[model samples]
Target: MAFQCQRDCYMQEFVTTVVSCCPSELKLENNGKKEKVKGFNVILKDTILFPEGGGQPDDRGTIAGVPVLRVTRQGAEAVHFVSSPLEVGLEVQLKVDWDRRFDHMQQHSGQHLITAMADSMFSYKTTSWELGRQRSTIELDTGTAKPGEIEALERAVNEKIREHVPVTVKVLTLDDPAMEQVRSRGLPEDAVGPIRVIDIEGVDANMCCGTHVSNLSHLQVIKILGIEKGKKNKINLIFLAGNRVLKYAEKSYTIERALTALLKTGADDHVEAVDKVQKSVKALQKSNLSLLRDMAVLIAQNYKNNPNRGNLFCLHRKEGDNEFMNIIANEIGTEETVLFLTVGEEKGAGLFLLVGPEEIVEKMGPRVAELLEGKGAGKKGRFQGKASRMERRGEVEALLQEHSRCPHLEE
Candidate 1:
């Protein structure tokens, strides 16, 4: 039997007797965590809420004031998952979410028009389609579209919408002669009753189970956004219909205004302004790196020239990198002194390098890593790695000082 939703796509409310309601559970993800929710699977004599099928999402609404989370078709029955159970044999009111339903109707109907025009004009067959939340897509059998083909296709689809063509449904038996003319991807194995064919007068006739508008004008308009490469030798045509096009435009305008304000330029100059800013940032970064390298050499030379400087030396730079630390280590020479250097935020995660006698470096490397809440490995006379707790550097400095004072203790 055809569902009431399939029978009357425009029906918003219907009174039906509850045939059955049983305990059920729905699995859902909340904030990246998966959880199971307890619910009831309700079956009604008929429903205004369409079950998920034919690439259209299930309608969300209420059944006897209980929220319906999902609906799916099992064979001949439409199972509605609801928050609360409805008593068997009791009459209940079922409501359809009109806004969502209408949006789907517009997109589905628009797809039919586009598919027909593409096949007629370009010999491109629609192998598959998806009606998404933001935009919809139809996969064509061909790998590519000719220049101006998409624009022509878009113009043709909108012209049909302007024509206000009548869209009607026909219920035909399996043996009906008219079924031969209808386009189909073969009926479902468990399909019961007559097959429903949607006819767009003077355009196309296709077998479809989903709800649709009775007139092409209801589509308002169809916008072919662009094309995307698909698997194998197919191309997916992206598009927007009715309210979705308006929503997309509104969002795009909002982003444009924000960019214009931040760049202090008009929409037309946004690209050039961003490019110029990026180039300037890159030049500044290059200059800063050169200065840091020069500073590293000067600091190392100062320590080497100072005869009064202790065997243990420590330094931290907010802007130094691994290369800067290596440069300093090479300049000062680690044979006679223990050099402890760090780079990045003083109280946060950063890089650390320790260089000294092989014995001292190997023994103190792991301890320094632990105090900084990090890890490191060393061989010969150098140790280095990333540190997570730069705030604990004082502890590492103290350990190094003690080692320098009693250099023969470990030996």
Candidate 2:
């Protein structure tokens, strides 16, 4: 939406004259497509809703009791996006979303104080910042900062907040002497006429075009959450301000209480409790594995003593594994026998078929899986594969019996 703002905006409630209600163009976000949405951009002579700019989000509320979807700045005008059109030259009452507006003020003001202190105290210059929904971040021109340094900076910021210093905005011309005192990365190329500078009493003065609270006390408090390493050797300091600090504290306390109850240990002992439980689980797994190995050996001996079903020995055990089958095959030694083993009949099935004379097993292994509508791989005298057709286990046993009689036929 394109429009021009003749008067300065930033009033909580204001009466404005509607200049025009025209079809506005909006670029769709986050689809990598150059698409636009149709909406009415209501231009006002003056407005309270701040347009999105300077790392801050747009203010949303009602304009003439109609919900304003978004506000954008094209040149000097504040354009309000709404569903329906308003009559040109109609007078409308613009009400800014106070809760959202106040929250942004707290965070934006807190950032200025923190950035100023970071530069004055530690010589760390702020490169950029982001005003997020839950928290805010200021990127400093440094690789990293130590815990002590951050703690000290937080303390200094809170001290300024308690001081309740007046936050003032001043519009100065390009050649004004106050511009020399402004702390900024640089001015934009298209920056013309007067410049808006947010001055935090005696602490900071920076060229910015964002809304801020009237005083530092409105910030309530500033807490440094942590720091992240950003691109190009910069450090991003994560923080919360005003109501966000209260919300964060409430959530942290709730999480700590829940952890204590679940672990059956106090906050200080929770880590130790978790470590002890992990060790016990590891010991139990080791004991279970040894028992399975012993059981496999005894099962192998039973089959070795009695060559069941003539020369075709077949065993159908539920949930047996390839490891158990391999152990049984080794225990039987080098004998002239064929073993057809199957496991997991109810859900699915797996087969381990071994035939004497390694060459016969290698050639017949893949064929056994094919007969069961599955796939297999083998070498030496053992072959293992999965059979999706569990009902075909009986057919596999029958094939082994028929092959046993024609052993010389395969050779």
Candidate 3:
């Protein structure tokens, strides 16, 4: 086991000797394939880098200026994985990423206080917790939390923070009478030796291995974002603490400013304004679709007057969609005509459809898709699919025209 500083978590620097360093490789199985990754596993006599555990991320920093990529715990040892190797018995300098460490400390400590407060108030024990980059979540044992209950819990947690209670850690044996008295989530069956407990003055004490802030005041404030349903009737409480709360407020203000200007409304009226705009946009879309349908009918009537029309009628429209193509074909209302229509610009790919007699469609639909390097299917006399190789679409049209004139040309 490594010697933890125990004095203060904010202690940023240390000098330690490398106990051992090994050329390490991690083997991962992905999609039935074995992959090996090259790295180094390092051990130090004393380290300030906290390994990733207890639902909190590992501390990131430098070991003698070489980047420490990851850290993990095996038994009592905290293994530091590095990109480059360090020699055994070499004395080196260590540095911790203070900003990341402090942020984690705030969130983890805030979670502890919140969990304690909830358990005390309503017997809602914490099942699990996750510290995320933007927000954190605490899963409670209960299925639901009303808005009033949530507000009260937030108030109680913030009250503790304002009290500026000192957060202290104690190390004790399993047999110690204090062990039975402290509130713990419980210990692992295989656990041995001394257990570390975090005490928030008179509020609560629980066994925790994660780093924390020295005082509750450092938590700044605890804000409950919302509560969501979790697995098997549990409630997941989303929250932000300390610097995260300030960051969230800044982003919210920026978005609100943009919305107010775009909607020509005050900040408080933005939601109402947005609702009105959405209704207007939906009505406009319905009007445009009706206009397109009317235009399709006129085009089909004009095409029907052509004396040069053959068994195959091919058309392309840059602005057309599947609905437009289908409407025009249905308006023609002729069993003598076979329709091959494509939409979207020639420079890009788009949708296409085939409608004709069942025999002709079954024979030619697959051929068209093959030539266009796309896919489709048919039932009755209709086939539809997306085509990517529209640059060769002219060839598809010519082939269909030939087959329409002479059904046995290439068979």
On TM-score, the candidate that comes out on top is: 3
For residues 1-411, could you state the per-residue lDDT of candidate 1 as single tens digits?
789998899999999999999999998779989889999999999998988888888899999889899999999999999888789999999898999999999999999999999999999999989999889999999989999999999999999999999999999998999988999888888788888999999999999999999999999999999999997999999999999988989999999999999999999999999999999999999999999889999999999899899999999988889999999999998597999999989898999999999988988899899999987887889999999999998999998999899977762
TM-score of each: 0.81, 0.66, 0.85
In the predicted model 1, the residue pairs found to clash are none
* lDDT measured at residue 340 in model 3 versus the true structure, 0 to 100: 91
lDDT of prediction 1: 0.93
lDDT of 2 at 9: 33
Full ranking by lDDT: 1, 3, 2
Candidate 3: minimum summed lDDT over ten consecutive residues — where? Answer: 1-10
Model 3's alpha-carbon lDDT is 0.86
**Model 2 regions more than 4 Å off:** 1-10, 25-37, 189-192, 274-411
lDDT of residue 287 for candidate 1:
99
- Runs of candidate 1 with Cα error greater than 4 angstroms are 292-411
Cα lDDT for residue 283, model 1? Answer: 100
Cα lDDT computed for each candidate against the true fold: 0.93, 0.80, 0.86
Per-residue lDDT of 119-214 in model 3, one digit per residue for the tens? 999899999999998999999999888659999999999999999999998888878999887877677554556888888999988887788988
